[model samples]
Target: MSETPHEYPGQLIEQVRTAAAARTPLRITGGNTKAFCDEPTRGEALSTTGWAGIVSHEPSELVVTVRAGTPLAELETVLAGQGQCLPFEPPHFASGGTVGGMVAAGLAGPARASVGTVRDYVLGARFINGRGELLTFGGQVMKNVAGYDVSRALAGSRGQLGVITEVSLKVLPFAPAEATLVFELGQHDALEQLHRWGGQPLPINASCWVKDDTQASAPNLLFLRLRGAVAAVEAAGERMLREAGGTRMDNAQAGPDWALCRDQRLPFFNAPSADLCLWRLSVPQTAPVLNLPWAQLIEWHGAQRWLWAPASAAREIRAAASAVNGHATLFRAGADGAPDLARFDAPSPAIATITQRLRAEFDPSQIFGQPA
Candidate 1:
């Protein structure tokens, strides 16, 4: 069951048309929870909060169609009532996070490595193009292949292409059981163990490795989560405890910890120095420990690494990631802020050309803010 649909595509289209004709850029916003994630954009504010509500939800069909401005928490709550969930675990940085922001940011939570990314679940989308034309792509089912890739590409576009009005997402039922295990290991050893366990038939859903500065006695910690059938979770937990050497944590205790990690509420995310910027390095899971000297928090089975360093270290940090066939993003600037620092890695020449062409086609007047 869903609430009454709040359809405001007409108003959004008119707004885009006015901006396009006037050659004025429009900054798309929904809850503005992730406003700090990207470089600042200057434009007339185009808010989507008025265009909200769930259009449809079929639990048995494993799909939900929702208006872009609907709150992320509201959608999650509805799914929970149906014993379903967004398996990628999109992060709500703050209370007012919206579905549109989630799709635009394309950020997944702890289960990303095991499940997939935000783009993987985007089944369909309806957006207003720069010309103020309402365009729809993909569909509510996986079998609908027409324009499917286009819909998925919009997941991380950050409003460069268009204003997303509504989207249909694939959902999954909650796992029957889940367990969390913690181990005492250094960064290298934890990465090795994660790689080793990754090869086996285990139910490892998510993992995090961080130095618990709050607990001086036991600093290095690796927290692993398992999800699946009751028997499989139990078996995997027991085997991990015996082979890996760790303690099983109570769900009541571990659940909030996992949420904290997902939403970046852990102490490791806090900047110890006002000048230290937060960098997110996306590298291969098999990549060895980086040689950089900075505090780090490893996630997504070692594929996603977070570090705190000054903007001056940007070159070195990016070079290290590139050496391992990866790229790094300046996720957050320092408290004083580094406006000159590039927030994202530069795309290859070919990709850059393609991106330019796409932007020209979708937003010929350049009425939308720059791409993320």
Candidate 2:
């Protein structure tokens, strides 16, 4: 029998497989806050809390290679020291989300539009396939693969693509300063504003719309934040304000607010009700007057939004998402939510097929978390 160690279980991969080989259903966890995810299965629950550390950091080369278990906060801290960061700017779950969990889940925040998505920044990875054997693919260099690179396939495959052991990513130097532009607009106009600004070649990094279910005055608050060199960020901010009319918020608080907005990991940390639903909504900005059916807390220039509804409201949320040519998912169904409502989005056909094939390639034995 494999012994689990204190503080951390070093041979986490082995421990996970041991459970799987026994035909025991395994639930993978990190931070364990989003544990309510609708996916099903049971037997032994495994934690990667012990597998934490940074293997290497090449700030000058704009690369940071680390153990899968490292906390995103820690990694970001180190990157900030060097004025560098994960360009995609993924969200750190309120319960202290880990880097490994970040990659396995392929989550990104507001910076996605301008900087690129999580899959874009991943350069390489080390993981244990379903067979319990360690595997490595891609490398330190970006644009290394000429064809299918297994390194990136791990993104969004969930934990079904074996357990990721190490991660290598391409980072970027941080700008000297940044500023945010906040404005209130109706849902109908917000869609227009998003389309207008998203089209310009501005240096905007993150844009979002905050919507209230009641559709109060300026029901949707549109926020645009631009960053770069001190002069550059300010210049872009000024130009954007001139081009787009909006009230500006003190950017000093923008960092924390951005974190809270993207992951709902903050401000909503202790929401008043356990019945709150957090969703990631994707829709077309060009679409005219989107008839958003449910109550939503939107973010990321309306590209990504959160739907707050009753646990039984998932079917409607899914339908609304479909109408917008987008999708919604339940990372947290609410305080008292349903298990089946956990999965909120139906990926595009291409993404769906790719996700499935990746599961097969990485976990041929079909032993990870579930059948991909």
CA lDDT of 138 in candidate 1? Answer: 99
Every model's TM-score: 0.97, 0.86
Clashing pairs in 1: none
lDDT of the candidates, in the order given:
0.92, 0.70
> Which number leads on lDDT?
1
Candidate 1 lDDT, tens digit per residue, 1-372?
335333467878889999999998899999999988888877889999888889899999999999988999999999999999999999887899999989998999999999999999999999999999999999999999899988998998988899998999999999999999999999999999999999999999999999855566856989999999999999999999999889999999999999999898988888888999999999999999999998789999999999999999999999999999999999989987787888999999999998899889889999888533
lDDT of 2 at 219: 45
* Whole-model alpha-carbon lDDT for candidate 1: 0.92
**How many Å off is the CA of 234 in candidate 2?**
3.0
- Where does model 2 exceed 4 Å of error? 1-10, 37-40, 146-148, 211-220, 265-273, 340-342, 346-354
